[model samples]
Target: MSFASQAREEIARRSTVKACCVRAVCYGIACFAKYFDTKGLVLQTEQQHTAQYAQQMFACCGVEGTVVEKQRPSGILYEFSIREPEQVERMHALFGTTGNETSIQIDPALLRCRGCLSGYIGAAFLCSGTVTDPQKEYNLEFLTPRTNLARDFEALLAEHEFAPRRTRRRAVNVIYIKTSDQVEALLAFMGAEEAAAQIQRQKAVKSVRNRVNRHTNCETANLSKMAKANAQTLLAIRYLQQENALDSLPEPLRQAAAKRLEYPDLSLSALCGCFEPALSKSGLSNRMKKLEAAAAQLKQKREEACNEGDCTEQPAHRG
Candidate 1:
């Protein structure tokens, strides 16, 4: 089932309903229904729970309605109507509607307080609302062709400090909310506590996963940078050995060269850890720099001598 479907089902199946909110809920359903005019009242829905809820509402008010099942590509659809003259008139007067509604509008008189408004809006959502999965994205919206009803709904949301955005999708007015906090709060307000909890839980999981990925990426980059610097240090060490200049160096410099030769895989930072008293990275690094300078001087002199007397390319000294 969709996220919206689950939330709507939860809100619809609420049985311990307040008597006053029952009328508000029914009125919300009527205003957003297929039609609530002089002819009769028609409520079309795909949710069996919604049809049952509506039936329970009317039963409480001593009104009767009928439900007809229609076959559709998706599944069974329900068409509910109350065509009885007295029943239709009673339903309209319950919410202060004129019983000849040409343009649907929210009846402020029906919504006595925040609780009544929440129940009314919840029913209105059951009539024309959908929400995206919180794990994927945060989007909850109501779509209705009635412009006046949509405008009133927007105003209601704003009065309650909900930041709603409005747009037109073809012929319908789309009132959508994109923030997770607002979406979760609204769903909980409408009595879908479990669905709101899912949003909160998934948000925390995503945050932890993102932090782990960033830390792993940082370590990998540091390792890569260390490997490149070590390659240059290795080349200079091999050259000093070939020139037979390794034994002639200062003891600290000789030890630095010895460590690199023994632990060829270690970076300068790791190589520092192998010293008897544990050398600092800069201490080992300065030793390597001085050795490289000595090798460079010998290399320049060797190249000049080869130009004069044809000296041969010598093999690297492994020891």
Candidate 2:
């Protein structure tokens, strides 16, 4: 099952303070309902557990509502509507909704206790929130059609130090938390301990995988540098041999060149071990610099020889 489903199911199975539960269900209906006015009230969701929880909430509040189920292209939809004037009035009083504004505010009574606040946030999530797979990303967002309502929700989270961010996608406003710690904290606050643990496990796995990849890349880069250096040194030694300059070099330089030619794939430190008296990596590097310089001088001389030949072959001034 999806993480969102798991979280909602877990929350639905747990019990909370009666006042907290009433406020939570009220907030959910206000946020997710299709219509919430004196004329009628409608609360809809695709989650069966959420629907069942909503029914239980209404029952606890002594309000009667009709539950309807329908099949849609995406999934099953559960819609709960309270059309009776007396029940609708009771809901308005319970949620403290003004019923004429573009935004809904949390009832102050809901914030009087930490438990109530937790329930409010949890119910809001069950109605409109979605969490990305932790294996892919650390993101949990509540999608709401009303921008002002989303802003209000963001402020509510910020009031509790949740540090949510707000953005608009098409017509909906998204209030999201991106950090894994915050996502885990939110899940825990909502009574989904198992889901929070799952996020932590995924984070640990990702951390280890990233460390391994970085180590492998570092090794690959080092090997590539070693190979390129070895190829250049071999080319330089070959140039000296072709020019009949190898036998004329000091014994140490000649020995170094010979060893390099014999083991073209060895790293500088490894090649140092082949010397009679082991040379430090820096010492071997200095010798390589000398070989490169000698090869450079030879290349310059050949270029000069070619330019002179080209000049001599040209017809003497054609005045």
Candidate 3:
């Protein structure tokens, strides 16, 4: 039979059995109703407790986020990355305490994939834990074809606690454990709650590492480009300085040229290019040459002025 059909039949059988069993043991209908009401209240209380504990456990693992559902082809899954190496080690320690010999594998390789860890965790719960309530599930349809291991593990987990329910929506089944203390113990024993936080941290670290590497590479490339552009500009500026380019230039250009002359090897091209509307390389070259010619003329004029002054001041000399 198809899995859905089998599920339907199983559900029907269980319902009938439950109805009959309850009716047989009941002294009165009112008493049965009361019992069911109390059970529901207890279940709700446990769910709330579990949610709080899940939060605390996640916090203890140093994960400060809510548990999020991630969709996959085969089914929906819960996922968190380990950011702290210590949390990972703590998780490893939790799994180490379990004495049950199930095929629940937790290792460095498993750490990379949250789905894998979830599968193992679900399996471990199934093999050893009791399910007091039967409505919790982890959806299998979100998984890929033939990943029966995860699906089966989820089934076993549900069977141990409560009946699995199917919904039209494709999301990871959020099974609320009915027994809060048991859930806490399981978490403590398996180190799953902390491990969940650790997983979140690990993923965060990997993301950061990738970002840093990418930024570093980009910066390196940009720096190289800047250096090349600066080198060309500096070369032009030095040539102008050597040729005495400053005094011949217009006021603004002359000041810029003087500044370039002060650092003779500095790139005038870069300074010109940095302007709002960048100058063409040839424009920069022309401007520098003009400044050089002007500076040389000014220097010569100064020298002549000084000589004329000295000639005027000198006494008729010498015998």
Candidate 4:
């Protein structure tokens, strides 16, 4: 089953014994169902389990309904309709609706009982709510064709401290929550504890994976930069030695160069350990810079004096 279906099934199977909550559940089912009018009250779902649960709720409201099945391109649809003359009148009285209102809205009077909101919302969800898989994204929404009813639903969510946004899609009003925290919270609030926990677990796994990827990328970039820098330093050292300018460098510079030549692949930081006193990375870096500058100065001087004399060597390190 889809994740949303799992949540709906979870909601549908929960036990509610309180009279107020039971009435609220029936109201929620009526509010989001396909129709709730004098002719008949109808609730439909692709889930037979949910259809069965709705029939039970209809019975709780002093009404009787039968499940009707229909085949569609997607799957079989199970509809529970209360059309008997006596049952229809009881259904209307149970919900406090006359089928004459301007627009279908959640009656505040229905929620006068404490702890009834969650049961009501949960029932509404089994009818018109859907939640995406947490691994794919964090999204949960409730749909209704009536704009006023959508607004009322949005207000109800807000009163319970949930942050929701509303928009229209294909002539349907959508009340949605986009963040992980809210989505998880709503699922838990609606009594889908396992579904909510799964979302939490998926979120944690994704966070860890992203953090590890960033660290790995950062380390790779640093290694590439270090390799390029080591290559340039080694080139300068080899040219200085070829031109017979190594002996002119200071004793400390000579030591840094000698170690670098001995271990051509070692980075400056690693090379620090080869020294007797274990030079700091910054100290080794400075020495390497001076050596490169000295070599560059020598090369420039030789180029300028090449035509004047056989100036192929230097006795003093160039500044």
Candidate 5:
């Protein structure tokens, strides 16, 4: 089966899977109704809206009511009611949805101006700036979401040499364009290159935000190792030492290992929490061991010299 057919089937399967067997069968039956004429479906008055919608679309596009219908091998009925067969070619060139024509009803109350930058202003809202009507009507499903809508709209308006007034209604943004002709021009630009670019920019921004969020989430869980110090961290330690704890150790260690030695008793993993740009636990442990071993060797050498002097002085008298 075709991918779309399979997708539709999958959607149907999911919708029915959670219901009782009888309810599931009812869902399957509903799926089959898609092949028949919209009017033929047994539904409530409000639910019979599709039949009326299809008829309205047929009239708007100047198509006759008569059309061919068929039952498919998959048990779904397919119907075609284009006003003209050439309308199919025109639609494919225009909106890019292939095969059957569907009706889109836009409410003036819900529709917002797309501004001068877009070709879709008459048919759809640009969905940006401050809308005076908080309850403004627009095609919610057809356009991108409202986040950054004003910024996007302004950018598009700048591109088109139109200055749009930004206003807010009920916290929703609306871009006010002065003329209806501009709205028509905006509608005309729908599915055009400039509109596509605007939408593309929106998608790119969304992608960047998503990537940043994912990175932060991963770091919180996985960046547990003690990282090595950068120049800034080393500098911070140097400044801290000049103020206090001056007599704790020799000057060489104070400068070289000052920043990293803050949590001397901690294991590498524990030490990572004490600084910025943390190093791996193993790396921190190794550096600490090397410093400790050197200090131990120096102490041992001093003890050996003192013991030799004592032995040389006492042994001569005993003999």
Candidate 6:
């Protein structure tokens, strides 16, 4: 199951204080339900768990509501409605709503107590919240159809120092937390400790995986550069051999060239270890540069000789 669903199920299984449950149920209905002139309310959701949780909360609050199931092309939908005037009035009082309007607004009184605040946020999430897999990304958002409700919810999150961001996607308004720490805090606030821990674990794993990939890529690039340098060194050594100049080189430079040709794949540092009294990397590098210079001298002489031969082969110009 998805993390969002898991979180909702966790919230549903936990026991909440009566006052908290009543406030939560009121918030859930106000945010999710369609109202008819203060006399009736209707809530439709695809999640059976949310519907069941709402029913339990209403029962605990001594409010009467009906649960109905409908089949749609997408899936089964659970519908909860409160038509009794008395029950509607009680909900309206708890949420400070007029019930005549469809827009949702948070009443400061409903969130005065910490428990009540937590419950209301949790219930609002059950209605329209979703979280992306932490393994892939950090994103947790509440989706609402009403722009004013989304703005109010953003303000509520800000009051708690959550610093949520708001955006509109088509007809839906999204209030989202993109930082992993904030998402974790939201889960904890909603009383889903296990889900919060799971997100932490996933983040740790992702960080480790990224670190490993970067290290491996660095090592591979270093190896490639070392191989290219070794190939160029061998080509220079070949030039010395063709010119019969290897024997005239200084002993250390000749040794460096021979060792490099013998083990073409070894790095300069590794090649230093193969020497009889283990030369330092700088010592071996200096010797190799001298050999390359000798090879370059031979190439220049050969080019000059070719140019001279071409001039001599041409007929003398008439005076």
lDDT order, best first, reads 4, 1, 2, 6, 3, 5
- Among these predicted structures, which one has the highest TM-score? 1
If scored against the real structure, what TM-score would every candidate get? 0.84, 0.66, 0.30, 0.80, 0.24, 0.76
Give lDDT tens digits, candidate 1, residues 12-66. 8765367778778888888778888886788889998888787777778777888
Alpha-carbon error at 310 in model 2, in Å? 22
Worst 10 residues of 4 by lDDT: 310-319
Where is model 4 more than 4 Å wrong at Cα? Answer: 60-62, 98-102, 135-137, 244-255, 274-279, 286-290, 293-308, 312-319
Please provide, for model 6 over 196-247, each residue's C-alpha lDDT reduced to its tens digit, 9 standing for 90 to 100.
Answer: 9998888898899999999999999999998887788888999898778999
Q: List CA RMSD, all candidates.
A: 4.0, 6.6, 20.9, 4.9, 19.0, 5.2
Q: What is candidate 1's local distance difference test score?
A: 0.85
Model 4 error, position 131 (Å): 2.4
Q: How many residue pairs collide in each prediction?
A: 0, 0, 33, 0, 29, 0
Q: Distance from true position, residue 248, model 4, in Å?
A: 7.1
Off by over 4 Å in 2: 14-27, 35-41, 57-68, 72-74, 81-104, 132-140, 143-151, 163-188, 192-228, 243-254, 275-279, 286-319
Candidate 3's residue-wise lDDT over 1-319, tens digit each? 4322222222222211232222211111111111112111000111222223333333443333233455667665433233244543443343342223233222333222333333334323322222322124212221211123334534644644534333222433233333434443333333344423433455577689999999999988977776675555456555555655534446756655545545544455566656457766677667656654555565576679778885333467867
Q: Write the per-residue lDDT of candidate 4 for residues 1-319, one digit (tens) a residue.
A: 8999999888888888887888898888888999887687788889898889988977876789889999999999999888888888888888777766778889888886645898888988998989998878899999999899899999999999899999999999999999999999999998898999999898899899999999999999998999999999999999999988999999999999999999988878889999998999999999999999998998888888876787655668767
What's the lDDT for residue 83 in model 2? 81
Compare candidates 1 and 3 on lDDT and give the better one: 1
Q: Candidate 1 vs candidate 2: which has greater lDDT?
A: 1
Quote model 5's TM-score. Answer: 0.24
Output the TM-score of candidate 3: 0.30
TM-score, model 1 to reference: 0.84
Model 3 Cα shift for residue 266 (angstroms): 9.7
The count of backbone overlaps in candidate 2 is 0
Candidate 6 residue runs with Cα over 4 Å from true position:
64-66, 84-86, 89-104, 132-139, 145-148, 165-174, 177-184, 192-228, 297-319
